[model samples]
Target: MADLGVKTPDVMTRVSEFMPEIITYIQTIIDNGFAYESNGSVYFAVSEFHEHPKHCYCKLVPSGMSNAELLAEGEGVLSGAADFVSEKRKPNDFALWKKSKEGEPSWNSPWGEGRPGWHIECSVMASDVFRRLGDPEGGMDIHSGGVDLKFPHHDNEMAQAEAESGSGQWVNYFGFKMSKSLKNFITIQGALEQNSARQIRLCFLLHKYNEPMDYGDSTMTHAITTESTFNTFFQNVKAVLRDAHQDDSAKWEGAETELGNAIDATKGRCHAALCDDFDTPAVMAELQKLIGSVNKYLETKAAKQEKPVVFVVKHAATYMTEIFKAFGLIGNGPEIGFPLGGAEGGAGKEETLTPVLDAVLEFRSAIREAARSKNFGDILSLCDKFRDDDLPELGVQLEDKAGSKGVWKLADPAELKRLKEQEAAEKARKAAEKAAAAAEKARKEAEAGIPPIDFMKALKLDDGNTPKYTAFGDDGIPTHGNVGEAPGEELNKNQKKKAAKEFAGQQKKYDKFVAKK
Candidate 1:
């Protein structure tokens, strides 16, 4: 406090000077046997005065409690004029007040709540100062500072202040360790002005709130890696958007809703994963699959699938945008970059190739027809037309095998097919005649043991391997179309006739046994 030339941790010195009510209470503690007056000084008899054992708060000390902070058996023998001071109490019993020499701040009391010893300051200042602030009952809400204030600082304050006030009314003391030696540190003003807030926030985010984390460069790398991974999903979406048909004189459109619906489903899954423990890796998995789908759509949308390009891209943009926003990324919309025609399409590709191919096929059909008519000259002429015109691109070569016995040699499938039918018919006819002859012989033999004359003859042939034959001329015509009688030089016609007659009578008598019939 400047008013008294006694300084504490900046504000504390001034507050102690202004708030003299706390000074009064420190004086009262001195009056009790728990604390004492010593040449105008006062100290707590920690063990003589409390329910706590010496080791109670020792565990809170990092390097372990020091005997220096403990009230030694012989230390406080110097403090005088108190009723129950003892030598055996711990050295860390601590002072409630100490006598001020000339020119130091002093006040009268039962003992006097004067200058607060290191521990006395917290209890006295908090209790009466808080009561002056109108929360006599609610001493303070929370006292958060550093972990280094264990043992002597915290434990001694608790023993004396709570003992004096007797209300046990104040909030529990919570110490957060602060040590320059340990490097568990930050300065608030330095953090706010950073150019890279994202890196900073992300670095802070990686640690669970209640756990300790050392500040380092690796944290920045994690933040950047996360950004890069998230950016990849947007890249894939852009690729998919590119698949939307080019804006031509005639624009093609697609179902934006469907593409959007699909993209949204993917994003939803990603967001859900992120919400669960901020699982960025799982979100990335969803992005990977979504981007893959986007690539597939871009590659296939026009050529292989029927969807309209614009429609697909519109929805892809919608879902991808929403998901990208969640990850703080963005997309550049589709542009007309696709080439006008596809791989096999030539210049005026669909146009030129369609009619060209049709005409080629027509000409081929005409040439084949001419071959069918056995018009070899016409076939050769037409083949020449095809060879000279469309042959190069068509990629076919023709060779003539005009008289070969192969399926292609036959010009007309109909006639080649007709000749096959004729051969099949002839075989069927012969087979039917043989079957009829066998039936006729069987019927005649069944009617009588001596078969009918014609039947007997047929039966003989049926039983025999070969049958004899006789000629039955259609008319009384000579075999070679010569119909004159044979001429003789010496005999008259009547003389010849008489001789011929005698020979005929002899032939007739032999005819019954002869095979002439």
Candidate 2:
């Protein structure tokens, strides 16, 4: 719960803490003739309870269920416990207290050593929690659990609580059911791993609480996407607020009317939906519509210079926060300028982009801001080219949002390093090949019966330009640069081309000579 940012419930009552109360309630039911003792055990007389006008068995069961079907359905005992149906005078009668067998835990009772039954425990725990809160009336405003428990479990709980307290409508039950077998259930740890608590809450709010929801890929993905949209919308509004001139009440023409109408409509729908049985999905739809209208209003050109529009946006954002709070979707975290939580950490201490990537992005932003209009055009072109070419080589991606501001993030550092190494190796191999070619040219020229005009010119030869043999050495030594091997930098492009041509031409004779040898 701490990891997921879920707060602990205030009144967490344990079943064991209310064991004595459970026993007392069972005795109360027995004394009122609603329950009976059988074979040292006590069972709720469903038929007898049904006989009374107000004390009848709760019909939490399915509609159209026959008496026989109700009896069969109610026969489901607590997990790992056997039903004492043979001891009951009626098949629909449910156990209130069970006699402890040998080696089983038991408590001393009027009848014998026994333990309180399963359904009885919940009633005692709920009532005890209510009483501790200074409510002498043990009735709860709402009781909720899976619809699967509505039949025997919740029904039995309601009966015991109402029968003991002599109170009608002990709980306004919200029978919300989810099933792991049907893929609608996710544990807290599992849910928190993929999404924030706010996102999860918003997901539930997007659907009616009473209806079953399938917690699958599309459902969660929609939630995440919607959350991202809301975060971005709020961030954009904040940006507008920060840059707006406080004194400038300049309106964006019709932006005020449009946005004001949206706000009014949103508030109306939200109020109506919530008032009608807490229709959270309708409220969320209204919130989503409000966000869209706000974003469109922000996109107007006049909005940039208008303080009134900014104020309107800011006010709407505040109201959106209120809606978030109402849905318990207001996330807990330190605010760093803008709303941080969404698809990312949102201040949950989750891992964010590395510092190196952040620094690179900051540098890019600095250069982008420094560039003038023409320079910025060039820069933008350069950025696009680099994004398509060099940036990918480094395994980085650049995302350009509105207003020319962009974000850069690393995709894979290891892949980038590997690509760099591969490029370096390719460059080195090309250099070595060029050098070898130059060496072969030098050798072929030295043996080609051509004369170097001077040692100075030969030594000072410009790469790939035909060495002009301009100056001579003493003893007429025709200053050849290298007899066999030479560096590629010493050979110009033309010289290398000529040398390669000569080498190709002489290759047949060289092969013959080798064969002869």
Segments in model 1 whose C-alpha atoms lie over 4 Å from true places: 1-14, 28-33, 52-66, 69-90, 102-114, 125-142, 167-178, 182-517
TM-score of each: 0.34, 0.64
Where does candidate 2 stray beyond 4 Å? 62-83, 132-137, 182-185, 250-254, 302-308, 332-338, 341-358, 361-517
Which window of ten consecutive residues has the lowest lDDT sum in model 1? 475-484
TM-score of predicted structure 1: 0.34
lDDT of 2 by residue, 247-301 (tens): 7665656878878888988898889999898898888788888888877776665
Assess candidate 2 and give its lDDT: 0.66
Report, for every candidate in turn, its global Cα lDDT versus the true structure.
0.48, 0.66
Q: How does candidate 2 fare on TM-score? A: 0.64
Q: Which candidate number has the best TM-score?
A: 2
Model 1 CA RMSD to the hidden true structure, in angstroms: 43.5
lDDT of 2 at 230: 73
